[model samples]
Structure formats: structure tokens, C-alpha cells
Target: MAVLVGVGMLVAARPPVDVLGSFGSLLQTFLPWSGVGVLVLLALAALRRSAVTAVAVLVPAVVWCSLFGGMLVDKRGAGAAGGDLTVVSHNVHDGNPDPAGTARSLTASGAQVIALEELSPRTAPAYERALAESHPYHSVQGTVGLWSTYPLRDVRPLAIMPWTRALRATADTPKGPLAVYTAHLASVRVSLAKGFNTARRNEAAVALAAAVRAEPLDRVVVVGDFNGTTDDSALAPVTAGLRSAQEEAGAGFGFSWPASFPVTRIDQILVKGVTAVSAWTLPRTASDHLPVAATLRW
Candidate 1:
């Protein structure tokens, strides 16, 4: 049984198909937690004094480390101390009771660019007013928005969803013109009857990925609620060429959902033609999702 469990862990490390109705994607989402199973098996082996079982458990332990060992290292100093630009992304819950307060927290991050998702008609105004002073230039397309300290141009909506849920624009930073994309991908759900339901999110990812591929700018930054983790193969289309800021420079897993007690990161900051010097999650706000911030160097 221990050997079989170890083998299963190794198999799961490979990209899996969604033939079992999104099971593969779901598994990948929490794949890191598989290490817990190996630990449990080791405990059982000790209780039984079974040397073979203990040795078998080492298989999965090594596999898990090989897959994620680099992340365990402290990489905050991988890039320069003051990056060229600082960006933040958050999913302020649509029903959040205090949009003003949430906006305040984001401003305190000192990010040059901030992307917000799940903005409702009523709460969006509060955010605009609160963030106006710090982020003078801003654009809100449907539920997604981008607020920037730098000037914005060529702002337009992205047709990734039926209604507006994504947008892109050019930020004339001191470093140069950078193409910025903010998107709120379709939410995913899981159930016993339908298994993990990510069809909608997957479709949105495909469309977003297409636009990103066609972007003319050499320097690009994508920030928003991706609704799926980087580990999930479903996001491969969008994450293919780009690199995740958190994965490159964050201290840990950097989970950012369910702000009360984050378990997984759905919100993301991905970059192309830029380097992430530092990436970290901000303190919880009125919103259900925590904000993720990263500093990038050109």
C-alpha cells in the first residue's frame, strides 16, 4: 500500500487529462499537499516497525521535493532591491461590506499599478473615490479595473467572456511602454455529481491566452484573479510563455484566496520580458480574497 501510494504521487506529478471530469485539474490544484500522505504513511510504517514501508515512503518524499524544492528556498533577493515597477492584483469580493477600506489597503502597498476584480456597480464607485488620489489614472471595464500612477493609453475591453471581465491597456512607465492585461476569469466549482467544474474558466483562459499571444508589446504584465492556480494544467494556455511573479520571487506558496485563511492562490501576477524581484501577499482586507503584490525589473 505504501509503495502504491508513492507511485501514485509520482504519476500525479505529470500533467494529467480531465477525462474524469476536471479531476486532473482539481488534483493539480492541491498537488503540493500530497506530501501529507507520505508523512502519514511514514507514521504508519513506524507503528508497524516495517522497514520496507518506511523505505517506500521515501519515494514520494523525494518526488515532492524534486517538484517543489526550489520554492522552499528564500528568493526575495533574487532581483534588485527596488524593481522598476510594483504591481498589485486582488479580487475584492463583489459583496464586500467596505470597498473604501479595501481600496485603502491596496493603496498602502505602494504599487504603481493595481488590478481589481469582482467590482460591483455599487462598490466600484467607493473604490474609485478612495483610490483616485494615489492612482490618478484608472480604467474600469465591466467588473475588472486597472488603476495606475503612470499614464494609461489605448485602453480597451477584451472579449474573453460574454460580458466584460477582462481589459488591456498600455502604461507609459518611466522605464517604457508596457502592455498590461487585467482579467477575472470565470469562477470554478466542485461537486460530487459533476466533479470539478472548470469548463467556463477553461474557455475564458483560452480566449485570454489568444489575446496575450497576439499582443504586440515586448514587455507585458498580466495581473488579476485567474480563478485557477499556476499548477493546474488548465491554465497552461495563459501561462505558457509568461512567468509567475510569485513562483519566481515569493517566499512560500503565496496563497491568496479566502482571505480569512488562504489555502490556494487563484489570483496571480504573471510577467513577460520583466523580472520579478519580490512577490508577497498583503494583509487581509474587507474582501474575501487577499491581494498579491510583486515588484518587477525591466
Candidate 2:
């Protein structure tokens, strides 16, 4: 029974069946929690003291280990020094209580390039005033903004969705010109009737993917509140060529959401044509989501 249940989950992750496969792909976001659920089942089996149950427990034990054990291990393998650029991405909840305090916290993070999402017209000025001192060069397109210690050029807004939640820029760093993108994809909501309502998010993701693919810059970094983890298949289009900074250099599964009890990572920093030396989550701020940061080197 345990083996059967475990195999069923494995099949869901990449079921050859169409609809079932699609639904199962969403399982990736809660993969770790699923592993825990299986462990709970193992405990029940142990309590029953059935010889067969003990053997059966190994099925999911091995299955879950094979699926996510590697990610659980510290992946901060040997890397070079903190590179020439450090970037941070955060989704400052639109209804945040203290926009000014949050701005102060984010600006204090020491990231040379900072990307903010979910900015409101009301609070945008406070952040602008707070970040202006450190980030001399900044651009706001729609609700997303990029502030850089280095000069920024070729700035423009990207219509990944109808709303102004994404933008692109070129950071003229001392090292060279690096393409940067700040994005806030459509948010998703859960309903008992529809599980994960992601139609809009998925469409926007496709648009963002096309935009990234057509970008002329060889070195590009995308930072944003992606609204879906790299683990979710829905993000494959936008994540195709880029590597996740957290997965590459963060010490653990750098979950960044729901500030207080983050369970899944929706915010992200991904890069291509560059190496990530380190990635991590910043201290909690006044927003509902935490900030994610990463250092990169060419």
C-alpha cells in the first residue's frame, strides 16, 4: 500500500497522462511537504508493527529521498569570492503597513542592484526617497522598479501582462554592461473548486519568456516575484535557459514568501551568462514577502 501510494505521487510529478500530468506538476511546489506527509504515514506504519508495513515504508522513503534529498543538502559548493554585482528582489506587499521602514531595510541590504515589485503609487515616493541616497540610478516602469549603484541605461517597460509589473534595464557597471529585468508576474489564488488558479500567471509567464528570449544582451539577470517556484512546471518557459540563484548557491531551500511563515518560494533571482557566487534571503521587513539576494560574477 505504501509503495503504491508513493508510486502514485511519482507518477503525478510527470504523468504521461495529459490532465493528470499537468495537475501533478503543481505538486513540485509542495514536494518537500509531501515528503513530510509520507513520513507521517511511515510513523503510522511503525505503530502498527506489521512486518510488511516496515518494508513498505521504505518505498516512499526512497522515493522522496530520490526526488528531493539532493536539494535538502547544502549546495553552497566551492565558489569564488563575492562577485562584482549583488542583486536583491522583493515583493513589497501592496498593503504593507510601513512602506518607509521596509524601504530602509531593503536599502540596507548592501545589494548593488535592487529590484522591487508590487509598488503602489501612494508608497512609491517613500521608497524612492529612501533608496535615492544609495542607489543614484533608478527607473520605475509600471509598479516594478530597478535601483542601481551603477549607471542604468536602455531602460524600458515590458508588457508581460496588462499591468505595469515588469521592466528591463541595462546596468552600466564598472565591469561592463549587464542586462537586468525586474518583474512581478500575475498573482495566483487557490480555490477548492480550482486548486491553483494560474491561467493569467501562466499567460504572463509565456510573454515574459518570449521577451527574455528575444533580448539582445548576452549577459542577463532576471529578478522578480515570479508567483511560482522554479519547481513548478508553469515557470519552465521563463526559466528555460536561466539558472536559479538560490538552488545554485543558497545554503538551503531559500523559501521567500508570507514573511512570517514562508513555505514556498515565489520570489526569485535567476541568471544566465554569469556565475552565482552566493544567494540568500534577507531579514524580514514590513511586507508580506521576504527579500531574496544573490551575488554574481561573469
Question: Model 2: per-residue lDDT, tens digit, 1-298?
Answer: 6877688668755555357534654676666677776778778877998788878878888888787676676765343355878899999877778887887787777788999999888878878888888898999888889899999999999988887889999999888889998999888867798886778888889998999999998999999998888878777899999999988877777888778999989899999988888888899998889999888888
- Top candidate by lDDT: 1
Give per-residue CA lDDT, model 1, range 119-201, as digits (tens): 99998898899999999999999999999999999999999999999999999999999999999999898778887799999
- Candidate lDDT values, in order: 0.89, 0.84
Instruction: Mark the regions of model 1 whose C-alpha exceeds 4 Å error after superposition.
Output: 78-80
How does model 2 fare in lDDT?
Answer: 0.84
Off by over 4 Å in 2: 15-17, 77-81, 192-195
Per-residue error for 40 in candidate 2, Å, reads 1.1
Best by TM-score: 1
Error of 2 at 7 (Å): 1.7
Model 2 clashing residue pairs (backbone): none
